[model samples]
Target: MHRFANPTRFLRLAAAVLPFSAAVAALCLGAGLVWGLFFAPPDYQQGDTVRIMFIHVPSAMMAMGVYAGMAISSAIALIWRHAIADLIAKASAPIGATFTFICLLTGSLWGKPMWGTWWVWDARLTSMLIMLFIYLGYMALWQAFDDQTKAARAAAILALVGAINLPVIKFSVEWWNTLHQPASLITMEGPKIHESLLWPLLLMIVGFGAYYLTVLIFRVRAEIHQRRTRMLRMAQADRHNAMQAAD
Candidate 1:
């Protein structure tokens, strides 16, 4: 991990991996959507409404998974002062937030038909909503500070604290009565769903993972360049100040 601390090395690695990740993401996501929507057998009860699960489930998984990544990165940055780790946490926040939003939106769309309402304060739903707010708060903290170091520290602390919510979101269905169903695919007994529907859902999840990695690499590279440009400007300013003082 420390080997990746060098921006140049990390950028080279990212460049090598980006094209493959982008291609796999596009192919898998397109194929998964097509398979799930048109070919997969629909739920006997929910019928076509079940098609929404392909998008909703993948987004929901990525939403929590990305936050978990941020929390781990935050821990690395705080403990080891890994520069790339801090940037990763920063880069992941907005993407995680986007997936969280998508999860909420699609969940609501799915709920209207099954639950007879577009919204509910069920434990699972409410906990997921809180997770979304936590992502927003983490991003907002970065913008609130002028000092990058201070901001990163503050954001890291918040991320570590916010990680407590992940488990709450995960187990909310079990801890309390909720309209949301319990885990079907990831149970101790293995997936309860039939193989026909499961394969496409798995493909969508994989595609989303690839998509996140591709975006993260691009964002981190951009952030490194931005930091370098800022440092260069600051160096020029210091040189001008020294010259004026000598004069």
Candidate 2:
């Protein structure tokens, strides 16, 4: 991990991995969407509406997954003062937030037909909403200061603090009398879903993960270049001012 602290080395690594991640993302998402939507049999109960799970479930999982990643990166940044880790956490904020929003949106859409309402204050839904707020707050903290060092530190702390919500979000349905269903894909007994439904869902989840990786690499690389440009400009300004003073 420390070896990747060097931006150039990390960028080279990212360049090599980018193509593979992008390809996986495109292929899996294409295959998964088509298979789940057009080919998979409808649920005995929900009928056509079950198709939404392909989009909703994966987005929901990625929303939490991305936050988990941010929390880990934030911990690394705080503990080791890893610059690349900080940039990674920073780059991930918007993407995580986007995923959270999609989860909420799709959940609502799915809920309307199944639950007979477009929204609910159930434990899972409420906690997921809180997750979205936490994501937004995390992003806002990064922009709250001019000194990026302070901003990074502040944001890292918030990220670490907000991580407590993750478990609550995950267990909310089990802990409370919620409208949400219990775990089907991941449980002590393994997936309860049928193979036909499960396979495409798994593919979608993989695609989403790959998509996140592909985007994170691009964002982190852009951040590295931008930071380097800023440093070069500041150095030039400092040298010019020193020369003028000497004159």
Candidate 3:
């Protein structure tokens, strides 16, 4: 972790691996979608509509996973003052929000066929909606401040607080009387889902994870460049002021 504290080193590493991650993400995501949509057997009860699960489940996993990552990054930023950590946390907001949105959208599409409604206030769904709002709020909090340090602190605090929702989202189906289905792929008793369906779903989740990493590296590099440009401008302004004073 400390090895990546140097932005230049991180940028070089990111550049080297960016293409590979991007390619893997695309290949896996495409193959998973094709396998899941075209080749996999349909659920006995849900029929072909069960195909939505391939996209919906992975997006839901990524939505929560990304927030967990943000909380970890924020913790590092606050405790260790790692500059890159703050940039990572900041860069993750939009991507996480996008995943959260995709989860909600795909879930809605799935629900309409399964639940006979376009939306529901089911515990899992409600908790996930709250998470979406949390992501948006964290991003808004960052923009609310003029000082980057203060913004980082505020956003990090929000991220830490909002992380409580992750558990709620995960357990909502079990803890409450909800329409949402409980975990089928992961269990103490082993996966209940058939191997035919499970493998493609796993592939999609891995693809999504890879996609997030690829985007994260690129966004962090952009943040570093933006910060450097800002610093350079400040320095130039300071020099001009000093020269005017000398005159």
Candidate 4:
């Protein structure tokens, strides 16, 4: 961990792994889409409409996963004062927010046909909505500060506290009288899905995870560059002022 504390070293490592992450993401998404759209049998109830779950479910899974990643990174940044960890938490906010939005939008589309309504006050849905707001609030906190260091610290604290929603999203159906279905893939009674469908769902999930990694690396790289550029500009300005003083 300490070995790669230097951003330059981390960038080199990231460069090596970036292409592989993209490749795996492409491979997994391609296979998942093919299997989900054609190879996997249609649902007995919803028929073709059920196919949307292949994308929606995985995005929903990733939404929560990204938040959890941010929360952990936030904790690490607070305790260990790791710059990369803070960068990760900051860089991932918009992506996770986008994914959460997709989950809600797609879920609503799916629910319309199945539940005969576009909106619900269900526990899971409400919690997911709250997740989105929390993400926005975190981002706002970061940008509202003139001091970047203070912004990072404040956002990290918000992220750690917002983590309480993860469990609520997970166990929502079990805990409340809600219209949302309980866990299908991961449960104490084992998966309720068929193996043929399960494989594609897993593939889509892995693809989503890989895609997240790829995007995160890109965002972090850009952020590091921006910081470097800012530092360089500051140094140049300082040097110019020093030269003028000597004159």
Instruction: Give the number of the best model, judged by lDDT.
Output: 1
Assess every candidate by TM-score.
Answer: 0.89, 0.89, 0.88, 0.88
Whole-model lDDT, model 2: 0.84
How many clashes in each structure? 0, 0, 0, 0
Q: What local lDDT score does residue 127 receive in model 3, on the 0 to 100 scale?
A: 65
Candidate 1 per-residue lDDT, tens place, 159-234, comes to 9988975676558644664344543322111325668999999999999999999999999989898888887788
- Name every residue pair that clashes in candidate 2: none
RMSD of each: 4.2, 4.2, 4.4, 4.2
- Candidates ranked, most accurate by lDDT first: 1, 2, 3, 4
lDDT winner between candidates 1 and 2: 1
For model 2 the local lDDT of residue 140 reads: 89
Q: What stretches of model 1 exceed 4 Å from their correct place? A: 1-5, 168-192
1-247 per-residue lDDT for model 3 (tens digits): 4123568777888999999999989988999999999999987777888788888888888988899899999999999988888999999999999999998898788778777788866555666788898899999999999888889988998898878656765576446633444533221113256789988999999999999999999898888888878877888999999999999
Q: How far off is residue 233 in model 2, in Å?
A: 1.7
Q: For residue 142, give model 1's deviation from the true position in Å.
A: 0.8
CA lDDT of each prediction against the hidden true structure: 0.85, 0.84, 0.83, 0.83
